[model samples]
Target: MSVMELLASRRTYRRFEQKAVPQDVVEDIIEALRLSSCGANRQAVRLVVVNRPEDVARVQPLVKWAAYLPPEQGTPKADELPTLYVAVMQDTSIPGDLATDTGIALANMTLAAWAKGVGSCIMGAINKPALTRLLGIEEPQKLAFMVAFGYPAHKAGIVPLTEQTGVKYYLDEHRDYCVPKRSREEIARYL
Candidate 1:
């Protein structure tokens, strides 16, 4: 796909089909991240791959989601839960939080996974201390982000709405999906 097509196709895929992501594919994505543009070409990012449902269950409690989306339609079966997790970390030696930089890396993986018929969910707002303990990460550096990956259990598509439009994607009382976009003319400004 073209660059624009790829960008438009990307989405945060939280649901997953019942399958395991090949180790090599996960490795390749991480390899791509290693070559991503860092602050000073410092590849201080670390990724921990988790592929066990038991581990996912253990770690799931520590991860949180934005309130924007309703609770998931349904949870995957014990074995069907996403089995791959990429833990994005910032090195202590670095003098920065690396959140944005790491997000870029996660974004790369998210898009790349979608391209390869995989799905992913970028996670934040979770319990950091608990995740640190669960992942056995002892470095006092930083925890930039975490993402879960696997075959998608749901359809992959876009819900387009720019900031100029007041339309928003929100959940209804019945836990249904809705999108309300604001007209561009209403919010656009001429300087």
Candidate 2:
């Protein structure tokens, strides 16, 4: 699919089927991330791929998913959790904030994952300190965010920004996950 089509179809999927993402595919995704542009070409951003069952189980609780979801629909249940996770990190030795580089790497990985029929959710609301400690990530390498990946078990679609469809995502009565995005006209204008 084309880049615009990929972007248009991409959505943050919380529920995933019980399937495994191949090691080589994850490696390719990381390779894509590594090839992405970095600030000053410093390459401060790094990734930790966690797909093992034991490690995935340990890392699951440390993440906070879908902040906009109501209490009744909070966290994903065991069966609904992701099958893989990519921990985005920044190396402190690089000597600058790597937020932009992190974003670039994440975007590359996300698109790559989507192209492979894998769904993803980029989450920033993670318990970094606990995650780092659990994953044995030391000072120089600090966790920035995480991206969860798996074959989606539920559907998510976008709608134009409107009062009926506010900025936040929600599940309709039929349980369809709907994301509301601002229209181009609302986000841009002639110079």
| Model 2 poorest 10 in a row by lDDT | 69-78
How well is each residue in 1-191 modelled by candidate 2, as lDDT tens digits? Answer: 99999998888888899899887779878898879998788888888889998899999989988788875585778888899998888998996558888888888898888888899989899998899888788888889998999998888899888987789998877676899999999999999
Clashing pairs in 1: 16-153, 17-152, 17-153, 165-182, 166-182, 167-180, 167-181, 167-182, 168-180
TM-score of 2: 0.95
lDDT of candidate 1 over 63-98, digit per residue (tens): 765456534543344554676887788887766447
Q: Candidate 1 at 123: error in angstroms?
A: 0.5
Error of 1 at 115 (Å): 1.9
For model 1, give the RMSD to the true fold.
4.0
